[model samples]
Target: MAIHPTAVVDPAAAIDASASIGPYAVVSGPAVIGADCILMPAAIVMGHTTLEAGCRVHSHAVVGDMPQDLKYHGEVSYCRIGEGSVVREGATVHRGTLAGTSTIVGKRCLLMTNSHVGHNCELSDDVILVSGSLLGGHVYVGQRAIVSGNAAVHQHVRIGELSLVGIQARITQDVPPFCITDQEGNVVAENRIGMKRAGFSLAERSELRAAFGAIYRDGIGRNAAVQYLRGAMTTDAGRRLLAFYAHDSARGSGMRLYNEANAA
Candidate 1:
């Protein structure tokens, strides 16, 4: 381990040999940092948090802090960050609420600068919270979803897989898969570009288009539209879209129809 002289790390903390602690970083007791991770200047990793291999905690970021929830009562909780993730400058990722609950950040995810992930929030693999995005307590972000800069999600809301939440949007409900919503909470269109960049095949893209049409323009309720999508498209991607549409929360915002697809 290459720990800077100005850094202060607890003797009891488990830091891997391949990790690097930069100047003025402070790692308190009960923290475990894995291989190849980098803790930048003035960053603090405390409590019972575990940073998996290949992760990077940028300058001044704070991880594994106590929950802000009143019900926490000072109980012990864990924060687990998966491999190869990046927690950017000034970001704060708090631990769980109550005992046995975990605040998890999955592999390959990015929590941008100044973003705040509240207690009990879970971000699945490949999730991206843009600069200043704030996820309220107990919020869950599905895999590959992107919450744009300055967006705020309400507590307990679930953003489905591969969805795109536009800049500065306020989300109070679940977002269905492949949907894109704007700042005013309108479903402006589909996340075609995102899916394409994620290596979705042509047929899968077509299926998503068909599914979007069925869900928004078919003159049927969300459930009935999902049923139609299930019957019309048989790909695994199609199934995922239908499942998200079918499981949408009552107060959730619908996806939009933006003008054209942007190449990512």
Candidate 2:
């Protein structure tokens, strides 16, 4: 480990040989830093946390702080950062509460500058929290999703896979996969760009487009619409989208358009 002379690292902390600690960084008790991770100046890694290999903690970021929950009695919860992730400057990731038990940032995720991920937040692989986003306690974000800058996700909300949350939105409910939650927290459109980036083929994309059309444009009800799409549009993207509609409907309500045209 390349720890700067000015940094304070606890003797009990486990630092991998390949990790680099910058000037004035503080690594407190029971923390584990993995190989090739970088802790920039004045960053703090504390509590029972683990930073996986290739993670980057920028200046003044704080990880593994106790949860903000009133019921938290200092249980030994954790903040787990996965490999190749970036916790940007002044970001704060708090540990989970006894009820939820852990805050997990999956591989290749980005918690942007000044963002706050509260207790029990589960961010899946490739999830991106843009600068200043605040995820309230118990929020779950699925893989490849993007929570845009300054958005506030209410407690227990889930943002589904490949979804996009617009800046400053107040997200109080689940967002379905492959959908775009606009600044008003309404499902404005399908996340077509993100799907393309995730290697969805043209045919697959076409199938999803059809399914979305069926659900939002057709006069059919939600369950009947999903059933129709299942029979008519059979592709990987279509199946995924259908699954999102079904699961999200059961999980909790998403922001549904009042009119069919508004959904499209």
Candidate 3:
């Protein structure tokens, strides 16, 4: 372990031999620093936190801090940064609010500068929280989703896979898969560019477009549109969209679908 003289690490903390702790950093209260992890200057990893292999905690970023919830009564919660993830400068990731629970950041994710992940948020692999974005507690960000700069996602909201949330958007409802939201947080269109870059086939993209048309353009109500697509969708991507809608429906939060009437 190449720990700087100015760094403060608790004797009970587990620091891997290949890890590096930079100047003025603090690793306290049994936090586990995995192999090849880097804690940059002034970074803080507090109690019950675990930085998996190859993770980077940038300067002034804090992980595993206690939940900011009133219900948290000194419970032993956890914050876990997955392998190869990067927590950028001044970002804060809080631990879970309930005892024995964890706030999980998945592999290869990026928490951009000044972003905040509240207690119990679960970020899936390849998720990106752009600079200054804020995710409320219990938010679920799907794989490959991008929450744009300064966007604020409400508590318990779900951002779907391959979706792009516009900059500074105020998102209060679940965003569906393969959708791109406007600055007003309305689902404006399918994420054609994102799907293309993700290597989705032309046929799959066409199917998704048709699916979106059914929901947003066809004027058939959301329920009728979903029922139509349930039996008509052919491609895997289309099925995934349907599955997302089904799951959201099961949650009973009643996500508002953006249609022509709402767009006006």
Candidate 4:
């Protein structure tokens, strides 16, 4: 209830008693702001947006705006930010295009300054979108993945768990788990450092490295590699890597060899 007098919250909006709306913030009638959520100066939460408890919308961030898709014609859609997520200054997360659908940002995520998350994107827990990064519509960023500053991800791409995208890289294909793409957007190394930081066991890390080698260095076809890894590698980390390839991504199989040059 610390809403500033300068804030413009619609009478029909559902704002929790403990929520705080700062100066010049706008909350639309259909929007829902949960307990302990904070809307900083000039932030805009409109349309069918819902911010879960403890979420923070920093200054000038805009959520639940209409999607920019040419095919959109104002059918009902939504943008949902999960608990404890923080949308930093000047960032925008667009709503979905199709009726009843929603663009979702998962729990505890961080969207840095000026980042743009296009319509229908799903960002999983602990995902970090660095400053000025742009995610095209329908992109799926997996848990704990980090898209570095100024990088751009193509629509429909899937970035797997614990992956690291280098700064300003242009990502066009699916990036598998525990991998790192170079500035030129080529898969060049295992994200051993990230996995360690995430507390993967030594045995799990060893298995993941073997699985990566089997997929990329073995030179076998994608299907064969997947089958081989599924049976050979039994660690949790190994299973995670296999699961990423089991389903077909927009970029097709062998995501471990994503850029085709595979220098890892």
**How does each model score on TM-score?**
0.92, 0.90, 0.93, 0.94
Best by TM-score: 4
Q: How well does model 1 score by local distance difference test? A: 0.86
RMSD of each: 2.4, 2.6, 2.7, 2.4
* Comparing 1 and 2 on lDDT, the stronger one: 1
Give the candidates in order of lDDT, highest first: 3, 4, 1, 2
**Higher TM-score: candidate 1 or 3?**
3
Model 2 spans > 4 angstroms off: 218-233, 248-251, 258-264
Which ranges in model 1 have alpha carbons more than 4 Å from their true place? 248-264
The runs of at least 3 residues in candidate 4 whose Cα sits more than 4 Å from the true structure, single-residue gaps closed, are: 253-264
Alpha-carbon runs more than 4 Å astray in model 3: 219-222, 248-264
What 10-residue stretch in candidate 3 is worst by lDDT? 248-257
Question: Candidate 2 — what's its lDDT?
Answer: 0.85
How does residue 84 of candidate 2 score in lDDT? Answer: 97
Per residue, candidate 2 scores C-alpha lDDT tens digits across 129-227 of: 999999998888889999999999889888888889989998887787787777778776777778888898999877766665666545456578667
Candidate 4 per-residue lDDT, tens place, 1-264, comes to 898999999988899999999999999859999999999999999999999999999999999999999989989999999999999999999999999999999999999999999999999999999999999999999999999999999999999999998899988878888898877676767888788889999999888777777667656776887788779878888887888888877766433344324433
